[model samples]
Target: MSTLTIIWIALPFFVGFISYLLPRFDRIFSLGVAIASTGYALWLYTQPPLKLQLLDNFGVTLLLDPLSGFFILTNGLVTAAVILYCWNSGKTAFFYMQTIILNGSVNAAFACTDFISLYVALEVISIAAFLLIAYPRTDRAIWVSLRYLFTSNVAMLFYLVGAVLVYKASHSFAFAGLRESPPEALALIFLGLLVKGGIFVSGLWLPLTHSESETPVSAMLSGAVVKAGVLPLVRCALLVPEVDPLIRGLGVGTALLGVGYAVFEKDTKRMLAFHTVSQLGFILAAPEVGGFYALTHGLVKSALFLIAGVLPSRNLKELQHQPIHTPIWIALVIASFSISGFPLLSGFGAKVLTMKSLLPWQVIGMNTAALGTAISFAKLIFLPHQKQEKQGKIQPGFWAAIALLIGGLFLANIAYYEAYSFENIIKPLATIALGWLAYFLIFRQTTVKLPRLLEQFDHLIGVMSLMLILLFWMVLA
Candidate 1:
């Protein structure tokens, strides 16, 4: 099992390194790595959980528990679809190299039980993602990637400080070390994770960064990369069950705020990016079930971003009149509807779990976010798809989109396997109906402009800092 874990973490890094020597086979190498990692994750999931402690004196360890296994599966599935989509396209060898390296980083991040190793994995993921985001070499791409680099370094720095505090308080940096730690310390750490996880104010950078990056990069960003910050929080919640209430508060806050912004956004990728934040809120709201919640959301969100890659326009209004190819249209609606928690889909199950044990207000907040999510997705599923008959010649990357949708649905249902109760089926229908009405009545013609100052780098930093201070006050009060 340890050997397999090593293979799971090393194979992508090894393939990526060697691919530089044989650039001619970059596509083949990348495809092979993707398929292998994805298949291994799916297979490993059915087996028992495993953990390998390393450097116990320093509290460093590796984990393949159900939480890690579930997220690893999510990462692999998204990477497989991305590699397939990028195949035969004219991406540079550097693109494949960075992408594959990031794949390794995400796997390692998910599997590590210690903060030291997890932080290392996240830093590597950041560098690789920065390179991939800047792959186009355009001025705007470089600019966005730079912002990503800056924000990531800042957030990780906070995380390191928080980890140091943890070590000071409890004499360990492992998940087990979090016991008896101060709330101020945990709050500092959660704030850092919240920023990288794209939650609320700390995540304000996400909309611009994701919307500006290339489509494939956007898919990777919102889908796999964002999970770097999320799983650790899940681990913390598992280890320190006292923090569950805090996690719930953050999750509900993030869901409502993100979906509110997404409802009025006009850009296709931008809107989905906000939804990424929103869906993550749902995942966080149910920390107990967050493994599968994150898995299902990650897969569906990745599919949606990749579909946006092939669209003719990023503007919602423009897409409304555009005649989409029929099959592509179906792919769009399924992924959209799935994310909206439509009946019998992956989201429906995930959402039911998210609603479990919520307080009255939390439940109301999450449900309202669900309604907003439905309205936001309705823009894609209903608007300009009326042409219905335009069977234009299949575009490039079309089949890859279909594969992603089908694969995501299959994994969520088969691996996660949440049963459909009568209540689960009936609840989302009312939200869906309300969403439709709200979309037509209120959100359809609404145009909202967020304060520009809030999006600036200094402002984003200020918000994070203020959050840390507030967290400290709350913890100490």
Candidate 2:
């Protein structure tokens, strides 16, 4: 690794230690460290990939590719935003710990090349996320976070077993070297990674934990943390495209279930969390059908979550009752549109790219996923505070986040026009219209009216089935 890459990993650790040692000066130190790290990550993205061999005989290697660079940018960008958002929230030590560790783990995941290295990186990220999500010590927070911890630890166990199997079968831990081994090892690797990636039932715990956390923490969990799974999944895609038919089926099932769950969810944050799992399903499905839409989905989804993190409410209820008519609500509206694939939004480029990249299996299955996402976010069309009240001025950090989000829009437009066609834009718009219609018919009423039967059953099934599903996917897929 180059000096810059070394700093990329080291800066966060330095800041984390400093914040821990001197908790009084956390905000200043935290913001300074986050901005520097984000700036460094962006700079690194523009440079050539640095290759390094860490373990000699194991052939351990590291390289920064465009996909990894994109996520690195996301991890840094969102970490900076969250830290800034919490600047005056008076929880400096907690925020610093979560932010610094989250950034470090994400950077590590992006840089790892060997299974052992990747596993360690992911474990760090997951644990840091668990801390962030459960930072608040309320009963609900503890219960939800414990659920996240249990599911993630189980996923880690699956990963370890797979690593041992691969080592026994391939005699090496490097992803490249392992690829040259038997296809069965590759299959096992995918199975393990899929559990981490939050496939359907395997990831049932995601929605509960993600939505129950604080806004900034939820943003980290959604924008930077969840993408950790995608990092390994994307890399593994090259090795194991045909790991398990059940994995692909689970991807589709998760996509469907996520949308279904989100469509009826009353809480704003929980709905957003469900969408994350749903969106990941789409990404997982894409690679299965031999397309790169999964990468597109991951990037766009990460950006959307970062923007959503800055919103002022945890649910439609809060946004509805709280005084809006402020710049922040407007910004949130833009984010909703962007996530919903509105015309001239970043999501539009991503959706168009995804549609173009699809094969037969993806064309139909993921099309539904897109429409479901549109419907889930459709509540946003009428969801913002309808009435006006005394509003506070937007913070500088809020503006900073908006600027970054709008910049993302410009980048998305470039991607679209470079690969653009009239037909591409038309199809996504038509699908959006279709989604609007479906939202009116199926989801409009029940979204606000909580169904006791479904909610109870989801809680029961969601909690109980996650482990079984994860193990089954690991073994069968």
Candidate 3:
């Protein structure tokens, strides 16, 4: 089982190499490799000691525990969706690069249990992400990729320093062993994971990088890759007994930050990107409060990212200007509503779970997040001017997938107590209402300008994160 899992991790890279050698059939290569990898992951999950040692002394290990299985499945689903969407769109050599990198990294990430292995997997994903974003060689893509690299590298530095501090204390890289180490060492580990997990203020790189990517790439990055960071964070939160407060605080801060950026974001994709941060903040806050809440949020967010890519409108102007005659257009609206947390949708369920689990402070954190998302997506109302089209129906297969996922999300929210609660129902609705009201108050008028002070908010947050690291060092001293 372990060997199979490792092969699953390596499969994408092997296929990617082949694709590179034969770039003429990139789309076919992408789809075949993705499907095969997904199958391998599923098979690996079904058979297991649940743990496998890859390099025993080197502290490299693989795990196919329940948590890892869930993440792998999510990654597979989202990646498959993205690959399917790219079928009609012309393929570039970069598509193969992005797909291969995304698959290999995500597979390696979920399977690996050692800190060093996880770090290596994450770096693999990060480097590929930089290429995908900047592949067009356009000025915008180059600028965004550079910004992403700069911010992510800084985060990586902090993560590495924390890891070294942890190694000095624990002397082992395995998560289980690390958890058994001194409390101080465990704290350092959490700090490192927090940076990787895209915690609120420290995760500013997420919005800028993801929102700026091409639509398909944006879907893959937001829906699938960012969560590579998230899965580890979730695992860390679960393993470290004393990290609850710190993680929750980070969650609240991230949620607020995401909302703030989304509120003022002018582009549709950028707005969704900011919302990704806020939504992730909600997911992070969930497990800290206890229960299986994060899973639903993770699944729903993946779907949302894919939906955002497939939707006809690219931006606010396009949405408003484009004639909504196609069946795909309707599906897009359903998807948009679902993501924005319309009642009875999958998002509502996730939001409910979060609200039910949250303390007042946490609730406040998520409410602000929802409000920001609502405002940002509201910008979509202005989707650009295009020639009108009579509404034409879409293919059954596409609509079927959307409907099925939406329905599943609803069922998971309503039927599964481990993931849902009556308490969740009340708070999520309240948050949704508050979000809607906030959108009306702040975003209804297109002229509302965010303070210039907040324009460089990413830089400010990064500096503050640096300060936090310094403070952590001082406290340890």
Worst 10 residues of 2 by lDDT: 288-297
Ranking by TM-score: 1, 2, 3
User: What's the lDDT for all of these models?
Assistant: 0.82, 0.66, 0.63
What is the per-residue lDDT of model 2 for residues 1-477, given as tens digits with 9 covering 90 to 100?
A: 476666677778787888888999877877777677667656765677777775487754677766666667667666776776666667858668667877887778777878888888888877777777677878888777766666666667756766776788677787755545554455445545655666665566676677677767776777667777766675665555544344455567778878877888877777788888887776656443222233334334444455555556666657665555545556666666776777776566666665565556756787788888888777766654544465454445656655664666656456556545677767777877888898778776663554444333246345434545454455443
Question: How many times do residue backbones clash in model 3?
Answer: 12
Which one wins by lDDT: 1 or 3?
A: 1
lDDT of 2: 0.66
Instruction: TM-score each candidate.
Output: 0.95, 0.85, 0.82
TM-score of candidate 1 relative to the true fold: 0.95
Which ten-residue region of model 3 has the weakest summed lDDT?
A: 391-400
For candidate 3, lDDT tens digit of each residue in 423-446?
655555565566667666767556
Candidate 1 residue 53 C-alpha distance from true site, Å = 1.5
Clashes of 1: 0
Better-scoring candidate (TM-score), 2 or 3: 2
Pairs clashing in candidate 1? none
